[model samples]
Target: MSMFIRVKRKKTTYFLHCDPSETVLEIKQKLQALSENHVDDQRLILIANKLVLEDHKTLADQKVENDAIVAMTLKIRETGDWEEVVIDKPGEHPKPDTDAS
Candidate 1:
C-alpha cells in the first residue's frame, strides 16, 4: 500500500508519496530531488517519537505510518553539523487588534 509523509523544514513542507517498504535512504533521495540537498546531507526525524530515521531501515520497520510528520534537518557545510529542526506554523503569528482607537 502507498502512503504519504509530511516532511517539514523551516516554513516549507513536502508531501512525499511513498510505500512502507521504502527505505529511509530512498526517501532521502526523493527529498534530494526537490530539495537539491544530497542524501548524506539530509536527516529525517519522526515527530511522533522524536526518533531519527535510519538510512538502512524501511519506513514500516521504523513504525512510520501514513500522513506522518517528519522533521528535516540539513547539514551545515561550514561546521559539518546537522542543523536544528525548525518548523514554522502559519497560526503562530499574533493577530492585530480589532478595536479602532
Candidate 2:
C-alpha cells in the first residue's frame, strides 16, 4: 500500500505518494519533478516537527507517516554572494521609507 504525504512550497501544496524504503534524495527528486525548482536547490523540512530531512535517510528511518507535510525552501549554497528567497504574503507590503524634511 502507498502512503500519501503533503508537501508545501511557498503558497502551493502538493500531495505525493510516499515510498517507505526510498531515500530522502529519491523523495526530493519526486518533489523536484512536481515543483518548478530543482532538487539540488531545495531544502525539505518536516513542518510538523521542523526536522530537516537528510538525503541519505529513508522516510521510514525518519518516522514520517502518511499525510505528513514537508515544507520546501530554496537551499542557497555559499558562493561568496548572498541569495535569498523572499516570501510575499497577500495583503502585506513593505513600508516605504519617508524622510522628514
- The top-ranked prediction according to TM-score is 1
Q: Highest lDDT: give the candidate number.
A: 1
Task: Name the runs in model 1 displaced over 4 angstroms.
Answer: 94-101
lDDT of 1 by residue, 30-82 (tens): 99999999999999999999999999999999999999999999999999999
Q: CA lDDT, every prediction? A: 0.98, 0.77
Residue pairs in clash, model 2:
none
Scored by Cα lDDT, where does model 2 land? 0.77
The digit string of per-residue lDDT tens for model 2 on 1-101 reads 57888777656777888787888898889888888677778777787787889999998899888888877777556663323423345657667779777
31 in model 1: Cα distance from truth in Å?
A: 0.4
Q: Estimate each model's TM-score.
A: 0.90, 0.72
TM-score of predicted structure 1: 0.90
What C-alpha lDDT, on a 0 to 100 scale, does residue 43 get in candidate 1? 96
